[model samples]
Target: MVTDQAGHPLFTTSRDRVHAEGLWHETFHCFVVNREQRIVLLQERATGKKDFPNCLDITAAGHLLAGETVADGVRELEEELGLVRTLDQLEHVGVFLEELTLPGFVDRERTQVFLTESNQAISDYHLQATEVKRLVAFSFDAFATLGDETTTEVVSIEGERFGRNRFVPHPPEYWAMVERSIGQSSM
Candidate 1:
């Protein structure tokens, strides 16, 4: 389903057309934090994926299928990362306009962001092999400094070392907003 800039549902359409035509659609982004809230989870996208393959991205995220409400999107955590969580366990950060245009694709999403606290170890995650490769955690401070030259830490995922360049290149402002939200949530 397509939505207006204000995230009001307008009409239903196929997912392909939504991306191909840059139609606004609803998606969910969940960021997982450790018990102490000092670390945040990150997942590496599967290498075979079409867009942003093998890049480090949000802990777990997915599109809200047509007719799905924001709460329904919580299933993405279980579907993508094997973490089952109830709606009450999640804290809604806010809605965001996330738009990205590639040569052959345009992703225009009205993303409902959520945060959840978990102490689960990365090795314990049952990753969806087709969508997620492995999970990694970064210190909140270090992640907040992402995209800056001063930030230099290799992210190790299942014995593989990935540098900052391997991450999805979200704009600096996006990282800043996420950092602020996470910080506030931690307290």
Candidate 2:
């Protein structure tokens, strides 16, 4: 489904057309964090993915099809990460507008972002092979450091260090918003 700049429905079109034309569409992004441990979970996109393949991204995310309500987007969690959760089980952060342009593809999205708190081990996640390659853990403190301009790398819980290039590359403002939200989230 395509929509206006504000996410109000306008018309329906194929997914390829939506990205090809840079038509604004709705999407859901869920970040799962373990508040007590100050850790966050991120997923590695499968190498075969059309966009941003092999990059780390939100714990779970997907496009919201035509006629689906925002609440229904929670299904992405179960579909992508095998985590079943209800709308009430997550915190709706806010709707954000994201625009990314490549040589041949453009993506304009009204993304509904949510935060889910969980302490489940990485082994507990059953990843959808085609969408997610693997799950990784990062310390919230280290992630928050990314908000600083000079902070160049963050080490994952497993001891591997990575820079922003490892991520899907959201704008710095988006990362700032995520850092602020994580700081305010309660157990």
Candidate 3:
């Protein structure tokens, strides 16, 4: 079942149908930052993804399957990045409504945003090859600038050079909200 603007259940529908019809559904977005709060993790989407293939995206995010609550969606972090974390370890940022219309898809998601701090090294992550390519960290400042298209800072991922174009095109406000959330949580 999908939800309305107030997050009330609207009706039952298949996931594919919901996307094709622009129905708002629930999703979970988690950002894993370093303990010192200097950087945030980004995951390169695997080339096989149907949408935004090979683009750098949130540390971990996924849709909530039918009947799944937001807390249950936390499993996506461990499933995609091998980072096991409990709900109590995550600080809820806020809910966001994201709307994007691609060539043949209309994605309207009500996202539950969360943040967690970790000092885990990239080498320790066991990536799910089909969903994530690799993980990289960007300084909070650099990421904010990139999101706003203020600078084309070169970022190295596994020895390969990448720039703003390689990252997903989230609105500047989204980046700002993320930064603010991180700041508030660690205070």
Candidate 4:
């Protein structure tokens, strides 16, 4: 688990808290896109994770270490997603909050959202076993429809050794937001 600048758990100050003591901790989130207007990606979190297992998060995301800046953590995409894009290749989409409802979860993050465009096939890269379990590709619309219909599609993991596939259902509003983000990024 990642800690805040104060070296404390983020759940201590979530947005939902009246005094949100931990909300002061900063974090970042980045999104990637392609020229075809496709949002670059999101991975199916492995079920063994401590939080939000098997859920869909940003195309590429991680917490900023206690002394790290939002940009520093966002740069992890090159290693996590195996993209060769530079910091300039990423475009910030401002910040967003993903509050946790698991009571006393003491977490509120200032997500530094970003967007980028790339055509690189993810199959060439490797998946971080600790962070992601597999991957899936869908046009923004396809995901939107799946979200609205509660359809769980398959995601395949490509990594250093082999790949694994699994089915997942994601939030519809997220794709709707992604579509809008992609549209805005293209502009």
Q: Give the distance in Å from residue 138's predicted Cα in candidate 3 to where it truly belongs.
A: 0.5
* Residue-level lDDT for 180 in candidate 1: 80
lDDT of 3 by residue, 49-136 (tens): 9788999999999988878888998999999999999888999999988887877788888989999888988889989999999898
What candidate 3 gets wrong by more than 4 Å, as runs, is 149-161
State the RMSD for candidate 1. Answer: 2.4
Q: Where does model 1 exceed 4 Å of error?
A: 147-161
- Model 3 has an lDDT value of 0.83
lDDT of 2 by residue, 1-187 (tens): 8999987999989999998999999999999999888899989999999888999888999999999989999999999888999999998888889999988889999999999998899998999999999998989887776667666787898898888788887777777788789889764
TM-score of each: 0.89, 0.95, 0.90, 0.68
The better candidate by TM-score, 1 or 3, is 3
The CA lDDT at 68 in model 3 is 84
Candidate 3: C-alpha RMSD to true structure equals 2.1
Among all windows of ten consecutive residues in candidate 3, which has the lowest summed lDDT?
Answer: 151-160
lDDT of 2: 0.89
How many clashes show up in model 1? 0
Model 2 misplaced regions, further than 4 Å: none
lDDT of each: 0.82, 0.89, 0.83, 0.56
lDDT of 2 at 149: 66
Give the per-residue lDDT of model 1 (tens digit) for 26-135: 99999998847488888889998877898998999888887899889999899988899988899888887878887878889888888999888888888999999888
Which regions of candidate 4 fall more than 4 Å away from where they truly are? 1-22, 37-40, 144-176
Instruction: State how far residue 101 of model 2 sits from its true place (Å).
Output: 1.3
Best by TM-score: 2
Candidate 2 steric clashes: 0
Candidate 3 vs. true structure, TM-score: 0.90
